[model samples]
Target: MLRKIIHVDMDAFYASVEQLDFPELIGKPIAVGGDGARGVVAAASYEARKFGVRSAISGVQAKKNCPGLIFVKPRFERYKEISTQIRRIFYDYTDLVEPLALDEAFLDVSNNKIGCPSATLIAYEIRQRIYQELGLTASAGISINKFLAKIASDYNKPNGQKTIEPQEVEEFLEELEIKKFFGIGKKTADRMYHHGIFTGKDLKSKSIEFLIENFGKAGAEYYNLVRGIQDSPVRPNRTIKSLGTERTFDENLSSEIFLLEKLDGLVQELSLRLKKSNVSGKTVTLKIKYRDFVQQTRSKTLPYFMSDSELILDVVKGLLFQEELKDSVRLIGVTISSLNTEIKKLPFVIQLEFDF
Candidate 1:
């Protein structure tokens, strides 16, 4: 049986949330990030996107793109509150909801609580409910599987929906641009283009053996994707693999003393995150990025799991001085892996407050 999958993505989530709370920001080009020299945009409102402003770009560049662009500091706790509300709505229909981020998720409604057979209708209702309850708009794509559904969601974005019937999957993919396919990044698309693979049809023409020889293990994945054969399930409780935090300085720091000061703060933030998640790990990795953009990492595995700030800081300090400074540092990060968490299963219970 073809599994019914729906991928719902919030329209400019962070920026929209800011606009919703601050009436003056509505319809204005706003970015959810710092406006400082070293600040990067976490999200950009649709109005800001019109001016070529986008997420991950420097705040300076965003301002250059649109002089009227407004920058608001991120309120992560508020975003999480809204995200929880959204997930409650998803659980109303199905327990098989896989959240990719705070803004997007994949729902497996082939066997749903409401016994709704039409995935498209379920998606429409979900989007409507979100708008009605939270004043936030969402876009959705409905199809036979996760990959196609995710791709289709982007077809009609920002408060819209699309459906790709199982029968239409073949023709739709054939005409789809290779770069638009899920899991294919810009670099990979460029490599495919060099081999004259411009569209799904072109990708389908290559033999699996030829694909494997050129692209390694990913070649087989491409072959199956072009054939509409993705079978990954929508897992509601995804295991937490690792937790981390990082900081990028406005000015590069060359002194070891300054680097230690920065590490102190990072360790504290990471510890809070670990405690909130209720997980600890045995491995701590320190990441260093120099002013020239070259990156390096130093890792140490402890005999026991730890999440305390002091323990993490001790490991980071040792790593920081383990090697001499290659150049002035611009960014530093701490990551804890090899977690004690094996399988985290969140209890699935429908929220009763929502009428629908």
Candidate 2:
């Protein structure tokens, strides 16, 4: 059976919101991020893109490219509110919606409540409503699976919609650039290019065994993607196994005091989420990413499940203190896992099941 999937991506989300709030900046080149010398671009407006400005680029460098670029700091709270509004719009169609980030999500409208057979039409309507109601523009891609739909969404971007039927998958993929394929990061794309796999057509010609030998686990995925054999589902909403919070700064943190302040914010956010879900966690995980993009995580399991913000922060701070990383920190996150979903009747150090 051909499952209908839709990938909806907001256009220049943070920058677009800024333009929406400040009408005067609608047509101007806008960069939503810190404007400090060491700051990085969080999101760039379409106007900025003409001058080769982009997210993650240094603010100093962005200014060099687009001399008149306007820099605005990110308003995460506003973004989250807008994201909630968008997610509400998605639930109007189907509950089978999987949010990828603040600005993007996948909807499985194959068996929709609206009784709409055409997922493409549903995507168009959703985009229209989002623009009319939220004053935002969105691009949507409709296809038989998540991978193809995600790719199709970018094909016609900035308030555009693109559809890929089952029959056209082969021809559609043939012209696709390797870099445009999902999960193919800069490092993977470089290796693929060296191995003569620069395009979807080139990837299609490679044998599964040859790809597996070169790319390991993802090599088999490359084989499936080239043939448009994506079987991944639009995951239905389920109980969250973990709750976490992360922040990637515009500038790297070199001071321990600054890092501790950031960790305080993360702990507060995690505490609120954990309390809201009524979940206590036994394991606390700290993730750190260096300025050079290298990532590492440290986790500690407690003797008992805890929902205390102070203890969580203390454990994370202890882990950070032990690590002797001299590199400036680019990102930091805290996560709570290993939940204690006890039913009260179950004894400690035992697993019990009773059929009702």
Candidate 3:
């Protein structure tokens, strides 16, 4: 039986949320992230993108590109609350829901509860429900498999939906830029560019052996992917590997005293979250993102499981200060894992205030 998959992605999720909650931000270029010279754009409103502002770009550059752009610090707690509401909408249709992140997911509705067989119809309903219930808009892609669905969803974004029937899959893939193919990152695309492989058609012309010779094991995977041969199942109840939170600073910090101050705040948040879920762990992790977007993590395992904020803060402080200052730090986060505790995801609640 041909599987029916729907990929749903929230358009500029963080920025859109900002716009939804703040009417003044609509139609204005805004970004949700740090506002400091060394800060990075977490998400950009569509308006901001018009001026070339985008996620991962430095806040300084974004300002230079769009002087009128508004920068708002990220409110992760509010975003998480909204994400839960969106997930509930997905579960109403199918139990086979695989979340890619807080703002995107794949739903396998081949055997959905709706009794209606058209996945495209389900996509429409899901989008409609999200906008009506949460005052948010989502774009959806419907296809026979996840890869095509994910691609199709992005074709018409920010409150739109697309369906790629099985018969149309090959033609669709052939016309795409090589970069759009899953697993082909900037580096791989550069290599493909050097080799004169520029599109799906270019990739398809190469032999599996040649791809393997050039790109090794990943080449084999890419060869199959280009042929539209992905068989990865939509894993709904995938195990929660870890529960952690991190914050991006408005400004990159070179001062050890300032970095420790930020680290302490992160520890407090992580500790509260752990306690809320009644979860504790033996492994504590410290993540650091440099001003240039290079990220690294340092982790240590303790002899006993502990969720005490003071202890977590001490561990993080050691991990962070043990080494000399590298580049200015742009972000810091702390996490504890290995508890095998169940994750706490808030259920979606209908907002009666939203009228659609």
Q: Name the weakest run of 10 consecutive residues (lDDT summed) in model 3.
A: 347-356
The deviation in Å at residue 43 for candidate 1 is 0.6
Kindly report which residue stretches of model 1 are placed more than 4 angstroms away from their true locations once superposed: 243-297, 300-321, 324-342, 345-356
Model 3 ranges off by over 4 Å: 240-299, 302-356
Give Cα-based local distance difference scores for all models.
Answer: 0.87, 0.84, 0.81
TM of each candidate vs. truth: 0.77, 0.72, 0.73
Evaluation by lDDT, superior candidate among 1 and 3: 1
Model 2 regions lying over 4 Å from their true place: 238-356
Query: How many residue pairs clash (N, CA or C atoms closer than 3 angstroms) in each of the candidate models, in the order given?
Result: 0, 0, 0
Instruction: For residues 19-105, write the lDDT of model 1, one tens digit per residue.
Output: 999998999999987677556677899999999998766678889999999999877778888988999999999988988767889
Estimate the lDDT of model 2.
0.84
Residue 104 lDDT in model 1?
86
Query: Where does candidate 2 have its weakest 10-residue lDDT segment?
Result: 347-356
Tell me the lDDT of model 2 at 140.
Answer: 96
Number of the top-ranking candidate, with lDDT as the measure: 1
